[model samples]
Target: MSSGIALARLMFVVLGLVFIATASLRARPQSDVLIMRNGDRLTCEIKRLERGVLYASFDYVDGTVSINWAKVARVESRQLFIVQAEDGSVYEGALRTEEAPGKAPVRIEVLHPAQPARVFEQGRVVELHQTAESFWKRVSGNFDSGLIYTKGNDTTQYNLGVGLRLRRERWNGEVGFNSTLSKTAGVSASTRNESWVQAERLVGRKRWFYAGAARFLESAQQGINLQTTLGGGAGRYVKDSNSARFSVLAGLAYQKTQYEPASGSQNPPNAMAGLFAGNLQLFRFKKTALELSASALPVLTEAGRVRTYVNSSYSIQIVANLWFKISFYGNWDNRPPATFSGSDYGTSSNVSWTFH
Candidate 1:
């Protein structure tokens, strides 16, 4: 046999093996529920192949669907689950554990396969999350938004603010800033301004969540008031929904209000201790969310008396990475300006940009 002919045969053999390898990695048809490496399961209507990833519409508790996608993790039979190995081999069975479960090796049971059962070597199987995390952050910023509203007196002011956030875990602490401004004209004079630095940490693994924060506010003529608050609550996933977080929280907040009159007069310090309760939610369509809360001020001061307030907001996603947050807020007190009531509402839309 000629040397050139032998080389050509070898090349054909190599090409055949490559074809088999590529065909083996093809994605299977869609399924009802997809369980991720992070132990989160999503129930969605698997749409169609857009680019290369599987697009899905997640079912929400409130009869809505939000678009999402499956990470590039290995998937298996409709009845059984399997994860693929870097060496072109598959570990079949229920996904025993995440790719890297801290100190233990991930295990899988074939049950009916040729090998019957196998425990995956952490070194051989690539952790799907490691790559998915980085890839998602690159593209996730394309969508985000919310709505807020506030009201005081017969004259109500409306303000709106919206922004995007980067979330790590399925639930974790996120930092984002938003500002809203609005004015109301009525029998009584009114102006509203609200902005805050939002930070929240997920403390519970299961739905019993805990979070705390310090909010700094500079409202219309209200000067600067800082409030320190801590709270905890529980939530549940209704059936296979992805957008509703039904929760209730009760917490203590201490607020200090300072004001300097435009007439060059200094007002005495005003401090108030109060309790707040409300429901937190992520609404349907992945565009709207709401929180309805009330605060009670029982203690009285010389410069201030007992008062009660209600704060509620609705956030709407207008476009990719931008949203309009509107708040309906109100305040009522016994102090006589004789029938002192105020209501304020406003909307703000924020858009985000990323620089590589």
Candidate 2:
């Protein structure tokens, strides 16, 4: 089974390469150019500039490469782009770069005719996206997993995770899933499963209508076999800069739970709860990404309990689009169901091939 799963992951990589090739072949032409430090001049379509890297697709090359912006001596493009800076300012226009001697940061020149030329250091440029993006261009995400086996105890473990997102001018949608399982000879097996779907619609520059539903099933922790949450509310983007974003959200949440040992288990609460959530996302774009997030739900009924989730992750690129990821997860219950603990936490590392 492990071998089969590994093979499947390999197939995914192969298919991802094929898709990139096809897309590059079909990409619309643009007046974009990138000059590398090695004196290589590439005539390509600059799909986006994010974090500290530039994503470019070449008509001649079969696959796209993420170029470290620092390694790029200059870029000339006439294609319209939505550029965002670390200061939360945004512009729509082409980009020009003035090379600096040695490793000094290149001066980025934003050519906005209506507005004067805005100059910034390379690091201050948070994100750039082609304004001509299509419906498909707004889609991106990734999935990955890792497996382990122990011969001494005849034990095996595996963790899997996946995420997908679609973004447009007015709204965005995201879906995610994660699961972990372990088994040992003569020992009861344990498993955890989680999934969520979320959507947000822009109401202003930094405010949005937000909603999501999530479900979790865990047999080893809290003796919980299942828990589901559904809610909706508003979100405020505290920081909407190019390099990072921070958001806070609040509203109402409804929760239902089913504990393990179903026959005689303590029935968990089904209550209307006040929910609060926040998240911080940072993209180095060069090769690293970081995310920190949490959710809290306080029950108002006799339950007198609070449920919370905290998650953190860091990822670094290992190859073209394959990234090595380390993630930490925490589940907490101020008042747990009978036979359950108050909290559970763990970490996992895996490799994933991400796509956009």
Candidate 3:
């Protein structure tokens, strides 16, 4: 036992050292210098600036750090970057900073261009993604977990969620998971599991052709044991910028489902339905990002049944790599299997960690 303990401690030390040596975002073979307002300088790789934060990765013990973009006094780097301004101007060049005397606003200079250095205010520059980052560094997402317990009702619930998004030159892909399990003494355990994957190819700049698959398994009042669906659709982005995005999607879906009636009466335990589905999604990036999505599916046949779901959440950055999210979900089935309500809704809050 003592030998085993000693080996575990040695392994832990090795892992700690590895973590301290490597940063979350891989660095290219160039050193980027960043000057802070307090006259501090860091020889780190400037990863990207998004949502009012500048991310830097260094080969030191601190790994990666997020700096308020406004706190950066100046930066000098020869690496190419994709810079986007709030007024929709884009530049592909290296960046240098100019601080004029007195209270004049600092200006960002676009280098290597034939024209004289184009200068802009700090806040006007909304996005900067380094071209030196590898393909994988362009991907981003987050994971969330939630829990709820009721003493009087003797019930406890748990939730787990994860999402990943990847954007290539002209293509984008997203994968997401949302799962929940609930337990109560002297009663059946309830579980809801959902997973979805979507792929999109950009048409022009703001439009996309997309296809996806979804699998769902749910229990409790709604009473669906399994559901598998395939869908294809087109989408349009009304507003697409670094700080926020708004999009709409319309699609056709084919689904097969198996369910036990909520009232325990046999009302066709299986179903095959063709549906017209659509959704509207909005995302904002800030210290507190607000996300909203709503979807609806109407049965093609004369069954006159419809399914609608709405989700809204606010995510607040709490600390390094962590966020607190308060979310609400509502699902409706116009026509349930048998003797079930037409609605299911819940509100929850979670602390989520993010990695890119």
The candidate maximizing TM-score is 2
**Tens digit of lDDT per residue, candidate 3, span 202-250?**
5653345455556453545566655556666776655545466567777
- Per-model root-mean-square deviation over C-alphas: 19.2, 6.1, 8.5
Worst 10-residue lDDT window for candidate 2 reads: 1-10
lDDT accuracy of residue 205 in candidate 3: 31
What is the number of backbone collisions in each predicted candidate, taken in the order shown? 36, 0, 0
Q: All candidates' TM-scores? A: 0.44, 0.76, 0.71
Give the lowest summed-lDDT range of ten residues in model 1: 135-144
- lDDT ranking from best candidate downward: 2, 3, 1
Clashing pairs in 3: none
Error of 3 at 356 (Å): 1.2
lDDT score, candidate 1, position 254: 51
lDDT of 2 by residue, 55-112 (tens): 8877667667788776777888887677766655566777999757887877888887
The candidate maximizing lDDT is 2
Summed over model 1, clashes come to 36
